[model samples]
Target: MTNILTRPGLKPARPFFSSGPCAKPPGWSADKLAVDSLGRSHRSKIGKQRLNYCIDLMRDALSLPDTHRIGIVPGSDTGAYEMAMWTMLGARPVTALAWESFGEGWVTDAVKQLRIDPVVMRADYGRLPDLGAVDWSHDVLFTWNGTTSGVRVPNGDWIAPDRAGLSFADATSAVFAYDLPWDRIDVATFSWQKVLGGEGAHGVLILGPRAVERLESYTPAWPLPKVFRLVSKGKLAEGVFLGETINTPSMLAVEDAIWSLEWARSLGQGGLIARSDANAAALDRIVEQRDWLGHLAPDPASRSRTSVCLTVAGADEALIKRMAALLEAEGAAYDIAGYRDAPPGLRIWCGATVDTGDIEALGPWLDWAYAQAKHAN
Candidate 1:
């Protein structure tokens, strides 16, 4: 067992692995800000430049086509998703697919908020929505990766070739880490603080041709908040994607996001994906070595490369709590506990920011923590 000093008034021994607002960019320094934009209006030329740079780098990293409009909107991923739901959903029948919290949020908004007649397809926390049962003839809403459950859609093969309705995807956790079939996705939204390790105040909205067409033609039934209004002057506000916010944004957050995007560009998209996959594979190796533990996601092929969730088999709630507490006390890990709504499991964010060395160190720490809990029992 690793000699981890339990609670000894010391800091955490290794990196944390919670899902969102995950670990800061590796070696990121707060003092790097040369000109702070705290007091400046977001409409200023400098502010717009920063905003546009972030969008451009994001597009380059994601390889988004020039035809698609990218918008930096409010409310993180949730805001972008709600805006899309309210703006373009009334024209067609909506189908919502949910297997985790984020997806559930979209479903709730579709059914209650927008009052859309939705075909709800759902699954337990550890499973995925039945993709086969989905009718793509209607506008479909789904999350590419279920962050809480560590499950993801393996590919876009399930999407229909001749489907008329748009496919709205909440790809918050799947953006850079997983391969997104851009051709099939319409209004795909993600946040900066996810896989790319950026600040978490803005949502990145990518509107494909079909989604933009819907936005141009349909008028929402509800009142549009000034900030959520993307179609201003009867045209899609094209500048919003480049950095213009419908309302003012945190310039500091915007700068940090730009910095993160620059970092991603240096690493290249393939490198970013490789980094995430390697980190996840390292965690899988640890899981393979342990017989008492297993992945929370049933199928190996459906596992998430970003959010690595695993359960302690035969380990009850009390034991799991003890193990988690001991690990935190030892300063080996923190926030490794699974989501409350999810099955008892440790959810680790093995995104681009997390190093494989940290994950390797966590393996023995888990064994030690488990042993300590079993011995105490």
Candidate 2:
């Protein structure tokens, strides 16, 4: 840490780094949006095509398998995940693992709301639960990335190859930013808002063959809400997975999602993941040089390349809040505050839309902000 106190003069060109509703893609503007779909029914001939376009492009960007089903669903990622739990779980003994806030919420849903006596496993904020200890004979549910903690499962090597149970992943923050072992997961859910920088209130659900089989073959005992029901009268509602959404959708938001997918496709070879990885690397260089700041995730491999969370030594949640406020007031940063439920620190989004150059600019500003906070003390 440098003792000399001169604030960095250069500010990040685009300072919007909120973890959710992340920054828009390069060259993005309201004008690039598909205005034609506005005022049109989402199920209309044109509207359906727009929706299908989003599905198509999303699959292409993710390089999903041919057998997997990708569908648009209501209530964002939360809706899709709840639907999976309501419809597919309870058919088998369940294992629920939570490392942070969102993951913990799902575990609560499984045990409390759904009233399923799941085998619960948990880890404190900066660590991962013992994946090897989970019994695969029981259906399992977890988040691939702990968004609030900025810790992600390193890989899918821990999953048993011949496991009998289904694996449901809440991948809202992991899909585009990290490599997901698709074959290992039976069902996965994500919102358009996270890595892709699209509009919210809509979610993308991906189901593998096993997941579909579970929906088709098993009948859960609990009655499901209309919004969470994926099966009707002993069968999966095929139309919902075919772009005929269960409810009316925002065509404008649909268009925005489509455009973002197209932009990802335009990146050609490495696409969004490449850009995101580069941004994380840039920020990492900044963190390595400072002894005062370090990753919240103890292990380097577990650190998220998307949500770059940092913990400053001797800083309490209150002190971190003051520093975040100082950064926001300076116009050099915005929405980079840590998750409210998380230990106090800072979280910067390094998704594809965020320029590595902006991350580089943020380095000196972080230093300046820390200095100011220290001086205040």
Candidate 3:
């Protein structure tokens, strides 16, 4: 056991481990970002060029198929997802799956706001509901990875290839960290802040051919605000997918995303996934060695590689807070506490942008903080 009186001799070089707006790519600095698009209208020729370039780079990095269309939207992942729910649902029987706080939010939207009367499936944190039980005839909404719960579907094998209804995935934290089967997904939404470690308030919405067909053919009973409108005068808005945004976007944020996307392009999808896997493996080694620390998600196959959650022995809200504060004050880690809505524990970001060395170094500091908090209590 680590002694409470002895502080760890080593510290992580970069202590940022927040789940959202996660640690920036290694060696990132504001001076490195391009500023040519700043102080200019997003509708200008150069603005559209930069925006389109960003989309192209993302597509290249993810190897997204040409059969799908990608667009930049005003709201973060939430905005993009809500846009999908408001427009594409209700045309068919709907099913909403919830395993964590964000997933629950989607259920609320489907049930209360949209009043779609979706067949709801739910599981407690750290476990996934039965994928086999899902109805293929109903439009299904689910998160590819549960950010707060640290649980994820193992693969896309469960989705029906010939299903009549569309599949909407909230992939905010899963994209770029895992290999996503694009054919299984019809509509996907994410924010640059998660896996890419870029700015927030901007969202990326991807639409497969089926999703586009629904947008053009089906009309919802609810009134859509201009930002959520993807169709105009009975035709798909080609401009939105091509670089013309529904609303004004933050050019600085777009530039920041482009910088990260360029970094991702250099690494390639395999390299990015490798970095995330290595970081998660390093963290796993630390957890395996300590009997007091156990994964919140026990099953290895369904565990999240990006946002990994752990349960501390005899931990409660106060103890977890004390440990987090001690670590932060010692410059060992920041924002390592569990999500507010989750069970008391520690949530670490092991995404592609985080260095494996930092995660390896975090072990001793976590021991020191845990010991200190226990001794104090």
* C-alpha lDDT of candidate 1 relative to the true structure: 0.82
Better of 2 and 3 by lDDT: 3
Going through the candidates in the order shown, the clash numbers are 3, 0, 0
TM-scores, all models, native as reference: 0.93, 0.97, 0.99
Worst 10 contiguous positions by lDDT, candidate 2: 1-10
Output the number of the TM-score-best candidate. 3
The lDDT of each candidate is 0.82, 0.87, 0.95
**Candidate 3 Cα deviation (angstroms), residue 357:** 0.4
Residues 1-377, candidate 3: write the lDDT tens digits: 77889998889999999999899999799999999889999999999999999999989989999999999998899999999999899899998999999999999998889998999999999999999999999999999999999999999988999999999999999999999999999999999999999999999999999999999899999999889999989888999998899999999999999999999999999999999999999999999999999999999999999999999999999999999999999999999999999999999999999999999999999999999999899
Give the root-mean-square deviation of each candidate in angstroms.
2.5, 1.4, 0.7
Instruction: Tell me the tens digit of each residue's lDDT in model 1 across 84-108.
Output: 8888888889899988888898888
Candidate 3 clashing pairs? Answer: none
Candidate order by lDDT, decreasing, is 3, 2, 1
Worst-scoring 10-residue span by lDDT in model 1:
4-13
Residue 192 lDDT in model 3?
98
- List residue ranges in candidate 1 displaced over 4 A: 1-14, 34-38
lDDT of 3 at 137: 96
Q: Between 1 and 2, whose lDDT is larger?
A: 2
User: Cα lDDT for residue 358, model 3?
Assistant: 96
**Ranking of all predicted structures according to TM-score, beginning with the best and ending with the worst:** 3, 2, 1
In model 1, the Cα lDDT at residue 257 comes to 80
